[model samples]
Target: MSKTWFITGASKGFGREWAEAALERGDNVAGTARNLDDVQELVDSHPDTFLPLQLDVTDRSADIDAVRKAHEKFGVLDVVVNNAGFGHFGMVEELTEDEVRAQLETNFFGALWVTQAALPIMREQGSGHIIQVSSIGGISAFPTVGAYHASKWALEGLSQSLSQEVAGFGIHVTLIEPGGYSTDWSGPSAKRSDEIDAYSAVREEAAKRPSANDPGKPEATRSAILKVVDAENPPLRIFFGKAPLGIAERDYESRLQTWREWQPVSEEAHGS
Candidate 1:
């Protein structure tokens, strides 16, 4: 069966790769970008199966309209990928009100709006998949990118709750928590806060992290995404690269240790 996909941020990175993979497999895709010209190639290449849409996911109404357009064109939306977000690099203190708001508006609220818009359609069909493109930052916190971490972490929690809520409706929600990938996410597409002298050392240390130097190839994720969307029962969350597993293991172990250490205090606090 040919599936129809509505992918945001389809102009580049994982979204573009996944869109291409689906279209190549004879599936229909309504791929969106802020500038339709950025994704026009998909339309040119897969004329019959591709629909390019210009969208700013942060706009709630725009997201709803885009979803409606996709359903109108394809008649069904088997997959919806919320990949329209960018990274904001800065320490928590270095982040400004505007920067933090912008990050959440797009990374968190944008995905929320899209999910809200797609739910009714999916519930009507009684079958659909929602893929939220999160990051390793969604699970673990690191310095210098606190704002970015906050946004992804919000998504992680939102999707976790969404999975349970939509299960009865036959809708699946998966958060794609990818490790660092060689995408423009950290380049031209990223927003950087003003450098602070006090945070210089922290920035230097962050730059030395393995993820900063070693990033997975975005193209390598194509097969994994295809498998995930095709699975009869997909994972609620899946990491796209090798690095995330180890990082998650270490982070989880530390978190468990801290929770165990504080278990006595937690139980005591609950008492009358």
Candidate 2:
């Protein structure tokens, strides 16, 4: 059966690629960019398969409407890909209140609102998949991109809980932890903190690191996409890129060890 997929931030990055991949497989898609015109060419070429929606997921009501419209257009929603997000490359202290809010609005709350809107429909249908395009930072925090990572980490936590909640309804969730991709996720995404001078060394080093937009590693992105898209039962957490594996692995192992070390104390507190 041909799946019907709806993706946000679909003009570029992993969202665009995922939509194209789905369309190539004869699936139906309703892809949204803040400006639908950005994807007009794609929609024009695949009129039968692609429906472009103009929306900003941060707008809770708009997101709900888009999901409803997508369902009406396709008659079913098999997958909802939460791919709309941006990064704020700066230290917590260097960022402004507005910048922090903007990052959370798009990266975290946007996903939350859309997922809430999509879930009931999926539950009613009795089958669906929610794909969250989170980053390696979703699980592991680094030097910069603190706010960005917080948003993703929150999404990861929300999705993790959601996975368990919806499993009984035949709804599965895939939290895609892509390290870096050859998408406009970096150069275009790299936002400067107003207080850059206050944290110059860390900020400069962070800028040097590749992002999803200006990924220094195209091969890594390609490899990750291929692997992730082909997995039979893809994990709840997936780490992409040459660097993420080693770094995330070490972090994961260390966390586990730390947890084990703390278990005795935790058990005593719980009266176990």
* Per-candidate total of colliding backbone pairs: 0, 4
Q: Listing every candidate in turn, what is its Cα RMSD in Å to the true structure after a full C-alpha superposition?
A: 0.9, 3.0
**lDDT of candidate 2 at residue 122, scale 0 to 100:** 94
lDDT of 2 at 109: 93
- Indicate the residue-level lDDT of 257 in model 2: 99
Which residue pairs show collisions in model 2?
183-213, 184-213, 185-213, 186-213
lDDT of 2 by residue, 1-272 (tens): 67898899888877777777778778899999988888987888799889899999889999999999999998899889899988787788887898889999999999999899999999999988888888889988888789998899899999999999998997888887877766656578667577757678876676566453444443334445445544556577766555677768789999999999999998999983
Give candidate 1's whole-model lDDT.
Answer: 0.93
lDDT of 1 by residue, 1-272 (tens): 99999999999998899999999999999998998888888888999999998899899999999999999999998999999999999888888999999999999999999999999999999999999999989999888888888899999999999999999999999999999899999899999999889988888888888986788999999899999999999999999888999999999999999999999999999996
Query: lDDT winner among the candidates?
Result: 1
The residue-level lDDT of candidate 1 at 48 comes to 90
